[model samples]
Target: MSGQDPVSSPARTDSWSSKIDTSVAHPARRYDYWLGGKDNFAADRESGDAVAAAFPTVRTSAIENRRFLRRAVAYLAREAGLRQFLDVGTGIPTADNTHQVAQAIAPQSRIVYVDNDPIVLMHARALLTSTPEGATAYLDADLRDPGRILGDPQLARTIDLSRPVGLMLVAILHFVKDADDPYGAVSRLVSAMPSGSYLTITHATNDHMPPEILAAVGDADAQIPFQFRSREEFGRFLDGMDLVPPGIVSVAEWRAENEAGPRPSAAETAVYGAVARIP
Candidate 1:
């Protein structure tokens, strides 16, 4: 988990049409479609519809995951006294983005967003809007290559490595299969951060889903497969960090703002979320 040499240049041209394959369904684009975004194609809609058909709660899961992200960012900035953030696997920009949430709490908070998707890069301007007091930057990098993300010049300019940072990996790790060594990749990123930094995650899980629903979702033709983990397996990703209160609960139960109204059950949400601090 030691630091790797920085890449000389990590920026890429923002021309996404050449890079994006409209014929195939991309996970990010499909997620965008699920979230009622207009940045998706017919393929994405088709795939997303198929998955939604299989698991009627997929849309709910996506929306709840987003809510979890907003709450986590607010907690990190306001409660945890954090000012720097590294949000990897950032999908298409939507409401209540990481920078927006953090900067709202602390105007001077700095953020660096990382993603390999060409579509996300095309929409990077939406994510780069920063308040005069704070700064924001986007890196066209992959999650598997933590070195490239950690070493990018843009990231270095925005976030200070010596200070505490909020590391966000929401709804993304399921894409990293077991063979890709997701745990090792996450460790490398966490190791690069200074002590007191926090890690926030919201991941899809089958631990609480009914067998029939799981079977239906499993039969969907998502071009890229989702590797749903158990609650215990998801907790392992936060191994070296100290868990916050109400540790590793369903997304709906993670320090929510309101609990008076009826809410989706854990089985319906099918997502796990948590925040932990580096000791």
Candidate 2:
């Protein structure tokens, strides 16, 4: 047990999930519940319901945010010509993960996913399945500790930071709060990347919502602290970087022309997204 690979070992997976205190709500599980996933527990459902009660469009917001993640990764892999990705705060493995989307375009693409949740770690094996020509790794790390993530040996072995890589902060930074200096942490990671590197961010915002809509939420996401920012504040995170076309639009409208159905309105989604290059 001492030397076993936690991600690939069934016993380790059970060990990890067993340690989770199901009585309390967690961000990862809450998010999973909002996305109609079965991995969440009663506490997560309770939390999700509270948030949804306030923001009636929350479930739609969650779905649209995921779509932004997929489109951003595809653009990085296909359009930006990036083969390496560092996706921090990657939640539960879904239908089209970062590696799945990237490797579909470039079979040789490499990716490293980082998340703090033990449940996410339990599912790490699912995230690790990569194309034979490519490679994938998971780091059980927290976003607050950028140093640990940036300097991790597991990450170093998977993707070379000296080369261009895609840095994904999708829907995770808002949880960090201003006290943690999310912007500074982001800058540290950006500095580590080479000039051609790209950053993709999708964060919840109250900028589009009307006054009553903002009041409706009433801190329903209390289980996890969220600093709902403005469109300008979200854009500040990408300052000095070159934004991709249709910059900093609602999550639902970002390159959604190819999507099947009509995109949700900005106020309904209430999430700002953008992809920018280091240049």
lDDT of 2 by residue, 223-257 (tens): 67778998888988999999999998999999999
Runs in model 1 lying further than 4 Å from the true structure:
1-14
Model 1 clash count equals 0
Q: Write the per-residue lDDT of candidate 1 for residues 1-279, one digit (tens) a residue.
A: 001112211344334557889999999999999999999999999999999998888898898899999999998999999999999999999999999999999999998889988888777777888888888888879889999998888888888999999999999999998999999999999999899999999888999877987887877854786799999999999997899998899898898857445778898899999999987
For this target, which candidate reaches the highest lDDT against the unseen true structure?
2
Which residue pairs in model 1 clash with each other?
A: none
Candidate 2: give the clashing pairs: none
State the C-alpha lDDT per candidate.
Answer: 0.87, 0.88
TM-score on alpha carbons, each prediction: 0.93, 0.95
